[model samples]
Target: MARIRANGVELEYETMGNPGDPAVLLIMGFAFQMTRWPEAFRRSLAEAGFHVIWFDNRDIGLSAEMGGLATYTLNDLAADAAGLLDALGIARAHIVGMSMGGMIAQLIALDHPRKVDKLVAMMTSSGAPNLPPPTQEALAALTAMPMQRTPEAIADIAVKAQHAIGSAPNLRNSAEVIRQNAIDDFRRSDRPFGVIRQFTAIQAQPRWHERLGSITRPTLVLHGADDPLVRPAAGEDIARRIPGARFKAFPGWGHDLADAMSETLANEITAFLKA
Candidate 1:
């Protein structure tokens, strides 16, 4: 584990495999830490012969949270990615992101094309700012009040969070793990409002539909057929907008990529890179 001053904020990052291998940077979704990428899964990617780097975004994990209300734009976040690459002495690397991370990836591909070797955008959207905004139910879940984890509340919170975000069909863990992780991660920092504001900023960005054509790199778009948070429609629209982008979605999958489909995700991503 290490902290690197990036794009103005200190970012926490961890790596797997040798630096001599091809580099693969994995960015997590909104308000999530890099731990969302499981060790075993990261190992698989590393074993596939790529150096894998996973890191915490601004307000998550051990990274510096320059106060939740300071505000940040997608351009700012993209610059952070670029700064990270610069700090690591990497000119370019395979970039993969989930959900909001995908949004950042899109911006990076558009603004810093020279810094990315390939792009894999999973479970994300263009956020045309106006078109098909997240379902009210989805928004509600994202903005819902956080419930403290008590012996009695664990099951309920787990169910609600799972219901709102769970799309994994092949998950091996029970409800306990989900509850524990959620509670722990949510409390890692003191600012849930920061997440909300970032979501709002994303919502307020100019529609990304128009510029998807400019992203010419080999790109892979993955979505869960069962994703409830950002519907699969977003993925479809993205694939259509980008030139020669391959799209895939799995059934019984939801917003959280950590669950059942991670293996398939790793497989598809690795295969696409090789192809």
Candidate 2:
């Protein structure tokens, strides 16, 4: 783990693979720490001949947290990403972001075009009003009250939440796996307050549908057809708006990226970046 001062805040980040390889910057979703990127996933990308970089965004994990109300917009987050790249001495990188991170990636392409090479936006939206919203089950799971702060309680809640919004039953992520992941995540850091602030930041951002078309980078949009959180329509809409972008959907996947889908995602992204 390493820390660097970027965008006036200290961001905790880690790198994998050789520094001389092509760089891939991974931006995780809302309220998720850099660990959400998964060690195996990062290793896969590194093995594919890329230097993978995963970092904690502001107010999450080891990154600097905001002291007051969540006033920062998505653009601020995008600037933070750009600043991180500058601090790392990386001229440009393959920008990959999921959910809210995807929004930030789009903004990075729009607000700092030269800082991004290829763009991969996953399980996200363009924030267009007409897009389908989260399913009732997904909403219920998302809004469920936090469990007790104990590791066991947190792990149980995490498993339940994942089961609610995860891949179809046929998928391979067992409850044990989800529970262990939750335990590890909790052991790393438990800051539900930071999650609220991140959510607030998302709510405060403006719709970016009109601005997405302006992004000229080679882009790939991936979404789960069964995703209850961000519907497939969002990915389709984004792909339609971004000229020359490619869209792919996985049939059995949901809002959560289960272990079963990791290899497929890694291969797809690796191929896209290589192209």
Candidate 3:
């Protein structure tokens, strides 16, 4: 709920746990707000003996929007996160990112090696052209636009998208909770153009898949075996390319960070960082 100027833009961020503890900076993906990171998930990391930080990336949530520009690169987004760390006086921290956030985390580690102690890339791809693309249903979910900007309209599209790419039916949040979260997100910010801009940036970024080997930080790649958006092989490819990186896949998991997976992901990430 606080704002700081970073990378030439104002970013909205929140911190949990003591500043004195080891820091864990979380970067969410695509058009997602930091709130999509899940409170319980962040609390679990905080309670597990680390300071947890989550923030809205530029042009999303309460953060400054850049609609004036036609497009920006992921490196720009990555620098925004790195600058946030500098603004906060955090010298080094465990960096974690999901989906597109994971790609940004890779850039941070590559571009600002001294600022990252450990790296966790979850449910993300390396932009490998040969890798399998998203399943038709998942692609539709990601590219679907709201018919109208009304809260109900936005929430409906969100619900459908979540259902399309989320974990198995039993592992995801209840339908009511999903709908409510969609509504809450719409109320927070209804800028569909911001999402299109982000997607454009992702597509426009130069391919950096070959640079993974240069990332010497201890790295972990986490993915859901059931993920139809970014298949499990994508995560595996990242692990394979990064010299000493570890890969872990969950059987019932998927592209979405459902409530059922939070505790498990917290434990897995905590153990890796602690190691």
Candidate 1 — worst ten consecutive residues by lDDT sum? Answer: 149-158
Q: For candidate 2, what is the lDDT?
A: 0.89
- Prediction 1 global C-alpha lDDT: 0.79
Residues 4-87, candidate 3: write the lDDT tens digits: 999889999999999999999999999898889888899999998999999999888999889756679999999999999999
TM-score for each prediction?
0.91, 0.97, 0.98
lDDT of each: 0.79, 0.89, 0.92
Screening candidate 3 with a backbone cut-off below 3 angstroms (N, C-alpha, C), the clashing residue pairs are none
- Cα lDDT, model 1, residue 201: 59
lDDT tens readout by residue for model 1, 53-168: 98987766788775755776777778888889889998899999899999999889999999999999999997665445566666676666647535345445555666667765
Candidate 3 ranges with C-alpha deviation above 4 Å: none
Name model 2 segments beyond 4 Å from true.
none
Best by lDDT: 3
Worst 10 residues of 3 by lDDT: 146-155
